[model samples]
Target: MNVLKRDMQLLKNSNDVVLARQKVRQWATELKFSLVDQTKLVTAASELARNALDHGKGGEMTMELLVNGSKSGLRLIFEDQGPGIADIQQALKDGFTTGNGMGLGLGGSKRLVNEFSIESEVGKGTKITVIRWK
Candidate 1:
């Protein structure tokens, strides 16, 4: 895979989440993603960014424009160094939440993208990667 561009932003607050959404939308538009596709990617990015901030205490988001043969995709990586999840399966289940959220962030994000993967350790951190193909 070849990365055309890469950008990283800090997810420290609610404003940062908004900025992350704007950045994702901008990259999706640059890649000529359709309106619906762009919305899906942006929504997923927002949720992940918020998770990094709220649940993880703070983290970072990385956006990459990728090219592989005839396929082009936007990939997002969210990483946080906080008290990590103890049960990823339960966290991924819809309607399961450790906070005040409705518990759709992880599962909903997965449904919005073409690819999704998550890794977390009990006391280490969490990293979630998602890709939206065009």
Candidate 2:
């Protein structure tokens, strides 16, 4: 197994989000991820990408392909310089949205992956990492 890293600069626009999702889908497919797994990863990518654009005002995502022995995984890290989340616990709660969205992005994306983590500062920024193994 080997390790590979890729990075994308996100922008305050929808097109960048779409491109991010497409990159995730490509990596998932190249890894031979199951259809269900690929879909889950892509869906989560879309949600987080949107969050980076809308909430973060702009951010970046790092995608890594990890291989260990017979197993493989995908890791994504989203970072932004926008105003960070005020209440992480409240933000993680279902139906908790600061915007007009349905408020399911973070929680739902967490459920779709094997690992999820978030760090944020009120005035600094935010960082989120998620991983899915195959």
Candidate 3:
């Protein structure tokens, strides 16, 4: 297989977050991902989308369909120009949050995906990428 498709969705507000989740689920299902895989990917997309809105102020998410030989996968990249994470290690720890809500977004999303990575600059922004293979 090869790269099937790529899409970009802006996460400027709450509604975009919801749409992002729906799009991720649709893409997962279109690729014939298992129910469990679809759920995991969708859940992770929601968390990241919300983080982009609440923490990053606003951002965009890019979804990609990847294929290699007989295997295929979904990749999502969330980026924001808001104040970047000050401490990435601390942020990745479960139960660590700067807001009122429970701090499960980053770590939990990572756990739900087959691959996870994050990068941030204090005054710049943050970028989180996650991928799930099928």
lDDT of each: 0.96, 0.89, 0.94
Error of 3 at 95 (Å): 0.7
How many Å off is the CA of 34 in candidate 1?
A: 0.6
Tens-place lDDT digits, model 2, residues 1-134: 57775656565688888888889999999999999999999999899888888888888888989877988899999999989999999999899999998889899999999999999999898999999999
TM-score of the candidate numbered 3? 0.96
Candidate number of the best lDDT: 1
The window of 10 residues in a row where model 3 has the poorest summed lDDT is 1-10
* Residue 115 C-alpha lDDT in model 2: 92
Per-residue CA lDDT of model 3 for 14-106, tens digit only, reads 999999999999999999999999999999999999999998999999999998888899999999998999999899899999998799889
What are the per-model C-alpha RMSD values against the true structure? 0.5, 1.5, 1.1
Measure candidate 1: CA RMSD: 0.5
Choose 1 or 2, whichever is better by TM-score. 1
Tell me the tens digit of each residue's lDDT in model 1 across 1-134: 99999999999999999999999999999999999999999999999999999999999999999999999999999999999999999999999999999999899999999999999998999999999999
- Distance (Å) between predicted and true CA of 123, model 1? 0.9
Residue runs of model 3 more than 4 Å from their true location after superposition: none
